[model samples]
Target: MKITGYRCLTTQHDWGRPVGDVNGHVDSGITEVPILVLETDAGIEGVATGSTHDVDRLFPAIEGEDPRAVASLYDRMIARVFKSGHAGATFGGIGTIDAALWDIKAKLAGEPLWRLLGARDRYVDGYASGLDIALDDERLAALYGSMAERGYTSGKLKGGRDVADDVRRLRIVEEALHRNAEHPGLMLDANESWHRKQAVRHVSAIERELDLVWIEEPLRRWDAAGHAALSRAVRASVATGENLTGLEQYRPLMDAGAVDVVQIGAVWGVTHFLRVAVAAHARDLPVSLVGHTADAAVVHAAAAVPNTMPTEVQDLGSPIGVTIDQAFQDGGIVLGDEPGAGIRIDESEIAARMAGDGWRSAAGPHVRSHRTGLRLATERTA
Candidate 1:
């Protein structure tokens, strides 16, 4: 079927609790969710989560092409944005269309995306990530305890501030996960808030008291040398690359041996994740799928890969107006027999909530504080 046109919809993910990391948070615990719908001439439509800055500029690349030609269309879109650079929102835009194209391809084949991609089982292993830096101690325990009850044997906490507090909070997560497994895996995300020596010192102190599986984004995402140094200095594996937009961005880190666990963000679409996973596997490295806010479509791609460790489970529910054909059980995500990526959107529900619920704060988690790396630098020298 040939691609026709597309439309965008607005929705929101209500966490019902605060969600943030070292940067900051929305006190209301709500954020906007953008959905893209690709209309095809063969009476089939494909849906994807997240949006790019400009649809007009990118749509022409795939306008009359076959949606089933996903890889070629994806490459064409990248080339379309070559001079301007497809980083940030533009890459996300390319990714949004690419994800929708994959959905269409799978649906045309009359099989779930995972099955079409040759996965033996529909189950993808998962770990809980609360984005809980803004949450208090009582709430933290409650959230993780609930996830443990859902059979999650691993959990990642948000922390990069004080060593004493980080240690204390990590134990809380460990205790929560201990309810499910004897040696539950625990991870920490510094969110690119620490410098080299600072990340080493902080993570080293926590390692003395706890057995960490990994420490994520300890330094900046592009700091190949710093990440490699941190990887050698600490017992926990260094995991990063959730913020990177393309394959080229990951080459430096891979060459430097900086990342022990390669991470692919769900928002970057299926093609990018699959390519990156294969690249990481070629070098004998394990890859992990990072979840986006209320989006888990990439789990299908993750299941098709052999070296996938555990995909992140950021939320138990989906955004308003969205329904996913998957269930979380046995400490993993089980994809249903849905013919596509398993996401269905209700336009009426989104239209009703579009007016008031989807607003984001200007100073949200995406913005880093001026004192983020500076405070740790001062401490390291002192």
Candidate 2:
């Protein structure tokens, strides 16, 4: 069936705890996440969220097109945006549509997205994130102490401003997890707040103390040499790729042996997300993905890849949690046998929330962190 139409939408919800960037540069947080819907002539529809910007312009390229020709359509869309300087960024929109197309494919096949993609594990190991460096010890304990009860075995925290403060925050997260924190899978993200030397210094001081899994965006996403340096200097591995738009950008980082773990998502789409999975697998490195406000789309993305576990989750208690049959258990997330991404898009609820003025106000078309600089760190590079 051909594509009929699409709509870009946003919904706002609270993090339940403080939301902040890595490095503590911006601790206060607000939410205005993006979503997109692609409808087809056959009454099948595909939905994707967690940042589908400029989805309106995508209709012209894919409207009246076959969703089954997802790869061809995706390539065409990429070529269409190549000269306009939006090809990479548009993939956020294109990736959503690509995911929707994959949903259509998997639905027609009567299998879940992970099965369609070739399942690695029905459920992947997950870690609790959404830990704000800005949170004081008491609030930190209250949040993560509860997270431990929710079945998370590992976690990452928003960190980076000061090395000493970063260590202090890490200690608190460890304590909150109690026994689970023993082999602490805690990771830190500087959100690109540190220069290379500063990242090395901070990680050096805290790596042994907390035994961090990785240091994310400690230097900068693009600084291959610097990342390699920091990775060499610290016992903890250096990781990035959360904000990269395509594989071309990832190669240099890999070439430099710049990262020990690769954290990716919203880079291109589930298609490229899988591509990143393949790339990481070829290199024999560990990979993880962004987990926030995602329902089934990301669940399938994680399950289809091996060696990628403990994805960063936004919350266990979210309004969107009810949209799917999958649930978090045993420190892992498992999906059920539902066609497509298995995401039951609660359209009415989405519509209600999209009515931003009523229950809550959406952030904006652009990504915004309470602190201005944090937004720049995560923007997709052309």
Measured by lDDT, the strongest candidate is: 1
- Evaluate model 1: give its TM-score: 0.97
Q: Which residue pairs collide in model 2, if any?
A: 22-159, 23-159, 23-160, 23-161, 125-310, 126-310
- Mind giving the per-residue lDDT tens digits that candidate 2 earns over 47-108? 66655765666667788887888778877766666676454567677777777778788888
Model 1 C-alpha lDDT per residue in residues 1-382, reported as the tens digit of each score? 6999999887888888988788877778888888988999998998899675667799999999999999999999999988989888898888888888988999999999999888999999999999898888889999999889889999999988888888888888989989889999999998999999999999999989999999999998999999999999999999999989999999999999999999998888999999999999999999999974445557889999999999999888888899999888788898999999989999998888754332356557887888888862332100
After superposition on all CA atoms, how large is the RMSD of candidate 1? Answer: 2.4
Cα lDDT of all candidates, in order?
Answer: 0.88, 0.70
Residue 181 in candidate 2 has what lDDT?
A: 48
Clashes of each: 0, 6
TM-score of 2: 0.87
Among the numbered candidates, top TM-score falls to: 1
